[model samples]
Target: MFDPTAFDNIKFMIQAEVYDRDLAGLFHVHSRKDLVDLATLSRESVITFSLKDSADLRVSLVVKADLEKLAGELLPSSNALPGVSLHILYFGTERSLMAERMDLLEWMWGTERRYERKKIDSDQTGTTYEWHVYFERIITEEMMDELGDLISFIGESLRTVTETE
Candidate 1:
């Protein structure tokens, strides 16, 4: 049986290169107070943390049981175990930029994008796009060993790409 507490605490890290350094400048243009206000107004779910070197940005998503509904379909009925799902999302300055990067990553991993939508800022009228890649599987005793490594490998691969680019 999977520990619910452990699952609740699990956070996945995703890293991507910021090809255009000017994006960082955009953040600088606004004051800290203004930026906070913008973020509050924007209400973006994905929070970005940039490296000092300006090479890449890291985004973290906490695994939530409520968001695992789709994964539940793949669970075996014989067991009472709850299913876990992995969600990967990408955001960019432009809609096309986000879509193109998602396409390349999905192709490289052989995974299809699941939920995709444009998030419009109600107050500012600005737009941001999100592409969600989901993997669903039932947790099993034997699968536990390989599962950790698989997750780690995914995180490392993303980080490696950011480092190399």
Candidate 2:
């Protein structure tokens, strides 16, 4: 059982042991293009994070988790355990009004093109983004089924290609 108290205490948790660095997801994107032209020509907001390697003995240096998918699996049940009201607080969506309000930010910058002129303002300098998610369930047989299926698939798929390799 996961301790709910840990959520209030820990701000972040480090993930460990990932096999492939080249692939970002179940899919792949392979190409290089102008960042600016892509932004104007495309809708995706690109961001990158470069991590410094750690030398700690306990750290093996790879992390992978599809929490977005996992959260989808952990939906709230209509009925919950007695005295344990399982709360699945999902944000990063319209349901989270406070989170949405906090994310309301306007970006300001000098426009190089006439098309972007009116939108750019000097006071605001960057885009705003908000995200939140939660998973909840009382210990139950049906809940175990969801977890079992997810575990079985991951274990079978990311396993060895060759025996004893």
What is the number of backbone collisions in each predicted candidate, taken in the order shown? 0, 1
Q: Flag regions of model 2 displaced more than 4 Å.
A: 1-14, 17-125, 136-165
Candidate 1 has a TM-score of: 0.45
Off by over 4 Å in 1: 1-58, 66-78, 112-122, 139-165
RMSD (Å) of each candidate, 1 decimal: 10.3, 19.7
Q: Tens digit of lDDT per residue, candidate 2, span 61-138?
A: 111122232233344542323211111111122222233232221111113211111122235553222222112332
lDDT of 2 at 142: 34
- Model 1 lDDT, residue 90, Cα: 43
User: TM-scores, in order shown?
Assistant: 0.45, 0.17
lDDT of 1 by residue, 44-144 (tens): 12324333343233333323343233234345443345433445554434433355555565665674435554444545756655545566653333344
- Candidate 1 lDDT score relative to the true structure: 0.39
Candidate 2 TM-score to native: 0.17
Q: Pick the candidate with the highest TM-score.
A: 1
